[model samples]
Target: MSLIKLSNIHKRYGKGTNVFEALKGVSLDIEAGEFVALMGPSGSGKSTIANILGCLDSPSSGVYDFCGVNVSELNIKQKALLRRHYIGFIFQGFNLLPRTTALENVELPLLYRQVPKKERLRISMEALELVGLDKWCNHSSNELSGGQQQRVAIARAIASKPLFLLADEPTGNLDTKRSVEIMEILQNLNKDSKITILMVTHESDMAKYASREIVFLDGKKKSDTKEDS
Candidate 1:
C-alpha cells in the first residue's frame, strides 16, 4: 500500500476577488521506502504541498491519506498527533536552538512525546549516531558548522522514529560540498534504513539524489520520473 496518497487536492488563499489557488487538483502517491523529490520554481506550490503533507496545513479540498488513514478529515489536534508520531521534518534552516547542545535539541521531540528521560537520552544519542554527530552531542548549535547543525536537525527529526521524513530545501543554506554531504546522509538513511523520504528541492543536482523526481508548475504536477539506480 502507498505510504501517502493525495487525491484531487486543492488549496486556495483569500476569498472572493482576492482568491488565489495554490494547488489545483493535485494528486500523487508516495510508496513506502521511496525517496521522492519535489522540484519546482518559486510559487509553484511545492512548499504548499510539503506543508500539507507534513500536516502543517490542511488542503482546501481533497483527500489526503497517510498509512490508510484519512488525514484530510483529521482535526488539528489529531493532525498534531499524527505528525508527532509518524512524520519527521527537516528544513533549509537548521532550526536548532542557539544555546542548546546538539543532544538536547535532538531530545526535544522525545520530551514532547513524554518519553522517559533515560530512554529519551538513549534514543536521541542513537539518532545522533546515525547522523554521525554522536561525538558532537555536547557541542552547542552555534559552535557547529552548517553541515553539522543540519545533521543535528536530522537527528532531532528522526529521534521519534517517524514513519516518513519531509525535507524542504534541506540543503538550501549549504555550499555545494556541504549540500552533497547532507544529501549523502539522507540517501543512506533512505537506502540503508529503508526510511521513506519526500524532499523539496529546486536544484536539479540536489533532486538527482532522489530515486524519483516529481516536477510541479503553477501548482500542478508537470512530470514524474524515476531514475535508474
Candidate 2:
C-alpha cells in the first residue's frame, strides 16, 4: 500500500463570498522510500498539502489514507498521536532550544514518548552520529554554527526513528555550501535508512536533490516529474 494517498482533496477557508479554495481536488500518492520535493510559488497551496500530510490540518473533502488507514476519519487526538509517534519535521528555523545541549534537544521528543533514559540516550546519539553531530552533543545550541544547529534539528527529528520526514525549507537559512552539505546528509539518510522524505523548497537546485519533483500552481498540481535513474 502507498505510505500516503490523497485523493481529490479539497480545502476551503472562510465562507460564502469570502471562501478561498486552497486545494482543488488535488490527488497524489507517495510510496515508501520515495524522496519527493514539493515546489510552488506563494499561495500555490503546497503548504496546504504539507499541512494535511503532517496531520496538522485535514482536508475539507475527499480521502486521505496513510498506511492504508483513512486519515480523514481519525479524530483530532488520534491525528495528534499519529503525528507524535510517526512523523518527523525539519524547518527553515533550526527551532532548537537556546542554551540547551544538542543531546538534550534531541531528547525532548523521546521524553514525550516516555522512553527510558538509557535507550533515549542511545537513540539520540545514533541520530546525531548520522548527522555528523555526535561529537558536539554536549555543546549548547548557541555554541554551534548555523549548519551544525540544523544538524541538531535533524538529529532531533530522526531520534524517534519516525516513519518519514517532512522538511520545509530546511536549507533556507544556510549558505549554498551549507545547503548542499545538509542535502547530502538528507540524501544519505534516505538511501541508508530507507526513510521517505518530503521536502518543500523554492530553489530548483535544492529540489534537484529529490527523486521526484511536484509543482503546484494556482492551488492545483501543475506538474510532477521524476528524475531519470
Each model's lDDT comes to 0.96, 0.95
lDDT of 1: 0.96
Q: Per-residue error at 210 for model 1, in Å?
A: 0.3
Maximum-lDDT candidate: 1
Give candidate 2 regions above 4 Å deviation: none
Q: Name the runs in model 1 displaced over 4 angstroms.
A: none
Candidate 2: 10-residue stretch with minimal lDDT: 1-10
**TM-score for each predicted model, relative to the true structure:** 0.98, 0.99
- After TM-score superposition, the amount by which residue 197's alpha carbon in candidate 1 deviates from its true location, in angstroms, is 0.5
